[model samples]
Target: MPDRNSAAHRAMAAAVARMPDPVSYQETALLETDLVAAFGTCRAVAVSSGTAAITTALAACGIGEGHEVLLPAVTVVMTVAAVAACGARPVFVDSAADGRGMDLNDLAAKTGPATRAVVAVHLAGRTDGIHDLAAYTRATGLRLIEDACQAQGTTSGGRQAGTIGDMGCFSLKDGKLLACGEGGYLLTDNTDLAARAAAYRTHWQSDAPDAPAGTHLGVNFRLAEPLAALARHHLTRFPEALAQRREQAAALHRAVDGTPGLEPITAAAGEEPNGYAALWRLTLPDPRAFAARLAQAGVPNSTGTHRLTAAHLHPACSRFASGDLPHARVTVDALLAVPFTEHDTDEAIHRRALTIRREAVRWTR
Candidate 1:
């Protein structure tokens, strides 16, 4: 999306102008260093993509072949692909009733001897019940991985999303809160795990002859210098950007506060959401039809659609047959995601809220 005169274009061009035979790792990668400071994590390991970050994190945690990693059924396919990439089986866990987090009971039921870790996805920047999930993982002795791809700037109980679990993965893909065109990074406080992930990111080499050999199998998942530079520039504007998004989302939530047949999805106790996306849980019947009505009223919604389908339903995960994810199925059917961003003006936010309220009331009657 960058044009010749755009700042991103210039930053990338400047980065390209400094290119040597190849981009050096870590030494000149200011982005990863900045991420560690920004996210308050002890270490950050940049990777080619968010999925690569997950795979690296899994490898760092020793989750490999014959291991079972539990993850929400309502997640992007790339999440499961990360597990499969490690030759580990992805055990699908049902979603919570609120549709913002995983169902604890379902997670308990699905966890078994093969379950070595749990991937708690903070869907849409909402981290409801993450504290409880973290406690559960600690009690059960399972490694916790927070797939905070959708929650880059979000937090729960005063802790950053990625820092709460054993390992946190973030996506810098376009459209994300902290995008870099295409990149990702893993964060963790565990010294050993951090070193393991750093090495895994680049064929497990220490960039020196006497450096440790690849402790875990890995690929060339290094974050390109241009992308890292772009990420660093974006970070400079993130605080202001986050504040603007929260303000707009708050205005919209207030407008629909008491609208019948519509309830705004909220953050859990002690959690500060990033307001990356606006979600509403329908209290009326026929959610798919309601979403259609909303679109007709000039407010398009991603509801009862394929965008948030159950991951088990995907062909790539065919090994895990469907029909057991009751909570996920129900939540997907009733929830709707309205388009939102920091760019929306106050007037636009109010108008979208009004459109939602008007259609919700009309459908209820």
Candidate 2:
């Protein structure tokens, strides 16, 4: 959580005071401009939430009923929900050998005639296999959308995470790096897609002469003024916040280096992680026991955090399940995630690391 007296709060207050009307796009447009400049994208569309961003992007791409979208098995349920909202069926792709990213082979095996797009998730802020996934999608003529909600400050091969795909979506929810309570945006270089997204987010209200009113089906997904102002303020502090997170993550890594049964999950070559959380592969026989110990020690952690099961297994999406995704299931069981937020102090991180080391020693014994 941000301080109540912080610049972000001040920005929100200012936006609220200056609003002349109820449905204003002043601050929202400014936030979109900042996002475009920051991410080097040609255009940006601010929406109500991350889910809205994905749904709008999908609609902009002309995907709908009878379309099948490929998404990693290891992802939040919201990703699948977004596809469902667009009347598309989600095809779950298995995780890679390390359980960090999508398995390209599985993605290839799953791509069929109904497949129209792919949503590549940069899980835990790591952009490890996105480039390869992008290449594969291009070869198959499939549209690629990057779920970069956890990778605000991340990069891969010198390019921003969201800009690498046809379209990218980011979250600004409470726990996210650029939080504004609840907001999200989409980034893309395509002029047509950007124009469509802009129109789709606001009831398909377009200024184009040739486009009719409600040219395409759309709903109200606009970002509120105050939230957009707060998000803009947070964007200014992002560089410093990201640096702090990296430092803390490095400290945690050093502390857990020699601890038995704990192995740090690192980024692949040429990829940069945004340090959303310090992740590890728990080699211990009982990962749940280790996680419980960490929680008892005041260092709250997660095994998979809403990714414990494949998205297809969720009751809302059970009808889409085609087969078992063993790797995603195994990976979730063996993984451990420790979040390091902007609010955490160095001492707090050190204490958490010590607790992890202590617990690892006890559990391995």
Candidate 3:
């Protein structure tokens, strides 16, 4: 969340004051420009929320009824909801052995004739294994969409996480590294996809006077001007915020370096994480218990977000829901997450690290 005293708040205030109707105004266009420049993408389309971004991206890519879209099992329910919204079947892929990303082998085994696309979620802002996943999707002739909502500044194989796939989606919702209370954007080098997304976000309304009638269905997914203004202000400071998060994550990693049964889930080779959340693998029998203990010690932690449950378990995703995915279940059960913010001082992070180390030592004993 942006501080009340920060420039982001001021930007939002200015937008509110200047525009009585803040729907898809100049500020929103300017924010889209900033997003393209920041991420080095050819085009970006700002939308209402991350879920809307995902749905628009999928629809733009021509995924709809009867098409099977493969996405990781260890993701927020919204990802699955997006597929369902497109009238497509959501196919759940198991997590990798390390629990960091989708298992390519499992994805291959699940892909069938109906598979139209694959959504690679950069879980916890870590793009580990994404390059390989991209390669696999390309080889299999499947459209690749990166769900990079949590990966604002993450990179994999020398390319930005979101730009590696055919289309990437990002969330500017509060709590994300790049926040604007509630907004998101889609990125793609394909001009056709970009144009389709632009139309899809605005109820298929095109500005061209002689343009053909839109055949694709769409809804109102325009980003409000005030939110876009807030995002723009935060975008200017994102580099510094990313650096601070990395520093804080490193401090915590060092503190737990030698602790038994506790291991930091660092990025894989060729992947640079944005440090959105400090994650670790707890070898202890009960990671949820350790997370609870950390919370009691004044350190907020989680086994994963509540939305990390298997997609098939969610009532909203029952149309394509299947049996439990073993790897995703194991990964969720063993993973531990520690929250951090751009405003956290070094001393504050250090204190949290000390508490984590103390708790780890006590828990293992």
Report lDDT per candidate.
0.79, 0.83, 0.81
Model 3: residue 268 alpha-carbon error in angstroms: 0.9
TM-score of each: 0.85, 0.89, 0.87
Q: RMSD to the native, candidate 1?
A: 9.4
Supply every candidate's count of residue pairs whose N, Cα or C atoms clash at under 3 angstroms: 0, 0, 0
User: What lDDT score is found at residue 38 in candidate 1?
Assistant: 93
Q: Summarize candidate 2's per-residue lDDT along 58-154 as a digit string, tens digits.
A: 9989899999999987877889999999999999988988786899989998899999999998777887688898899889999999989888888
Ranking by lDDT: 2, 3, 1
Root-mean-square deviation per candidate = 9.4, 9.5, 9.6
TM-score of 1: 0.85
**Cα lDDT for residue 223, candidate 1:** 83
Highest lDDT against the true fold, candidate: 2
**Total clashes in model 1, counting residue pairs 3 or more apart in sequence or in different chains:** 0
**What digit string (tens of lDDT, one per residue) describes model 3 on residues 19-111?**
332234799889888988998989999999999999999988889988999998888788988988999999999888778788888889999
Write the candidate numbers in order of decreasing TM-score: 2, 3, 1
Residue 297 of model 3: what lDDT?
78
The worst-scoring run of ten residues by lDDT in candidate 2 lies at 207-216
User: What lDDT is obtained when candidate 1 is compared to the true structure?
Assistant: 0.79
